[model samples]
Target: MKIPGSSLVRFPGNDPKLMLQMPSGGRQNTENSQLITAATVCLVVFGILAIVDGVYYHDIKYKLYQDKESILEHIYHTVRAVMFPIMMYCLFAHDFGGVLMIVGIGAVSIDFIMLIFDVKEEGRSRNRYGGLSNDEYMNHVFANTFHFVAIALILAAKPAAAWTIDPSFALGRPYPQVTAWLGSAFVAGGVIAALLHFWQWSQYFSRKVAQS
Candidate 1:
């Protein structure tokens, strides 16, 4: 006797081993994999650039966390920081399908909007420091470019079915070794970013109270 929804529960070809197997050679499949790989690389580069800008320039060098002028920027970072881990989980940690994919897209879209606002507010926030340095400005340009490119590549790589409203979930990596490493790195980075932003906000609040 077969169970209800057994088809949904079963792996491809009813073989559990095949579920985690990488796709075999096909031009389209290969292209899609390449796109995902490139997007992952872009994300990694973006992460490094963000660390330089946020940690080295903003936190250590300028100590923007205690400045009232930087409060708006801090607010933007705090929100995006919280969303980053969820976005990374949905994008890299698993093969999200249907509604989950939609959720991931929504998260990315919101982050993009936040990025725009963050950039827009930087002029006012950094004006006290004589605006952004050339190095920091160039860093933002490259990081933003990579971020947009990654989104485009991911959207191109996804199939039409990924947009549909079907409920499906699975615990598996996108690729074998590389994806595992990328996913772990992204998720860890996201968590750390979130924590750092929260700490910055706390420090800022403390400074504000002391000044009062």
Candidate 2:
């Protein structure tokens, strides 16, 4: 049984001569911790592989220069992982698929907003070091709002398309194909982003390590 307060390392209170020889801080740090650094390194390596696939996947280089909201470019976004497939299905105005696409987009927006707030609280994600500054806050707000609106438009497009194109035939459903196709894209996007971020972190720390 652990005694209350027994975890502390105690030197004898009465040992006058022994006290003279002791360091001001007590014994060296005595606890062991499970460090995630090793895991992060492994993740970073895997992320590099994913990044290569992402950069070249689906002729992404060409698509990047395409229209900002174009499906081809959206397919390459692979960032949120869902944006593309839902979009593709939406492109066809697959009724249910389009709605789900908006839902997914909403989720991404919410998460991003939460992240912005959380990061801002911690003073992160702006400038070279990635923290929010006053000037950048509006930009962040605008970016998120735009994406959120994009999702809404995407959601709205399908039903409208289905309704307008054919009164007797229904073309849209719950976006199964879009969901399936885009699932990996979303996963790959997350892995890629994490890798890039960690790569930057490692570089920063490596430089500091070298300097020291």
Q: Report lDDT per candidate.
A: 0.72, 0.36
Error of 2 at 97 (Å): 1.6
Model 2 residue runs over 4 Å out of place are 1-110, 116-132, 160-194, 201-212
Error of 2 at 133 (Å): 3.2
All candidates: TM-score: 0.82, 0.31
- Model 1 lDDT per residue over 1-212, tens place: 12254322333443342232223348867798888889778877887887898789878987777788988888888788777777667766666655666777788888888988998998999998899789999998998888678667766776544555556444232554665477667778888888988888998898788889
* Candidate 2 global lDDT: 0.36
Model 1 alpha-carbon miss at residue 14, Å:
13
Reference-based TM-score, model 2: 0.31
Please give the clash total of every predicted structure, in order.
0, 10
Residue 40 accuracy (lDDT) in model 1? 79
Off by over 4 Å in 1: 1-25, 171-173
